[model samples]
Target: MIQAFVEGGWAMWPLLVFGMVTIGAAGRFAHRPQLAQLRFIGAMSLLTFVTTFHATWLAISAVLSYLSKLEDVASDQLVKILFTGLMESTRAGGLGGLLLIVTLLLVAIGTLRLTPKQG
Candidate 1:
């Protein structure tokens, strides 16, 4: 779990940075509360899903492996061999999602935080 978080965070950092810069650019071009708020909400939801899904996938494999180990089926052997493959895919997807969310969240907050004073 900790490992998942760490790797996810690391892999996500770059993309998040990119998003911050990118969204900042978008805001410069089409700054609007509606759009910024929407971007922020979308990002938070996406990151939440990415982290949750990665954790769930890991949990599933653990349960499946345990069951297979008990039954002495090929699932155990296959599971061990396929560990890297699954982890790689999950990490890639989860990190990308996480980064996008983080980026969007930053943008949303910035929009609200830096709003101009109303006349």
Candidate 2:
């Protein structure tokens, strides 16, 4: 159902597989029908989704940089393109700072989201 709406792309297969596997595993240890159990499953799935989003954002960022910078090069050589992307992003913000900011922001949002409900 989600794949249908999200345009699936290449990431759908991997995320679907992971979601199914984890949901199944969690069911093994807990009663999935319970609300708390469902919430946990949701949190886990959201985490996985966030990880995929970060990875994909990085990949697309790299690809765009490579394509825009490379000249007179064949597109078939994606491996070379990938390396070029890594080098460029690394040079842009030195990898650590950008990833740190992204990760910290994600953590902050998650913290706010998971805060206890007010009375």
Candidate 3:
């Protein structure tokens, strides 16, 4: 959400840039017939996974906070609750992201193996 991005501060800027670069790299590699393209694509995919994981964590934290009835709670208490939720979401998102990256790398490797070698 927009709110989450805004609240994510300066850290979000790099994530945005990473996402854009990843898209560009993917697009470029998709059209190229070189086997070496997979290395760049794989690296970009890893970066993309990192950004995606963080964004997911922030979104999850925002949604959890919004759903919880913390409106009347003290500021300190609210911060604590949000922090706890963020920590939990970070762990979950990190593992999910790692799994995704691994799967992507495996698929890329499989594709590379299937493609006929060029002289």
The clash count of every prediction, one per candidate, is 0, 0, 0
lDDT of 1 at 75: 62
lDDT value for candidate 2? 0.48
- What's each prediction's TM-score? 0.36, 0.37, 0.47
Q: Tens digits of per-residue lDDT for model 3 on 29-89?
A: 4444456766776786777776666666666757585748556888888788777656544
RMSD of 1: 8.2
Candidate 2 local lDDT, 1-119, one digit each (tens): 34232432345445445555444535432421333444555565565556456545665675776578877777678667777555433322222233334434443444444524511
- The best-first sequence of candidates by lDDT reads 3, 1, 2
Model 2 TM-score on a 0 to 1 scale: 0.37
Question: Candidate 1, 9: how far from true, in Å?
Answer: 17
Worst 10 residues of 2 by lDDT: 89-98
Worst 10 residues of 1 by lDDT: 7-16
Better candidate number, 2 or 3, judged by lDDT: 3
Q: In the order shown, what is each candidate's alpha-carbon RMSD?
A: 8.2, 11.4, 7.3
Off by over 4 Å in 2: 1-21, 29-32, 73-119
> Which residue pairs show collisions in model 3?
none
Order of quality (TM-score): 3, 2, 1
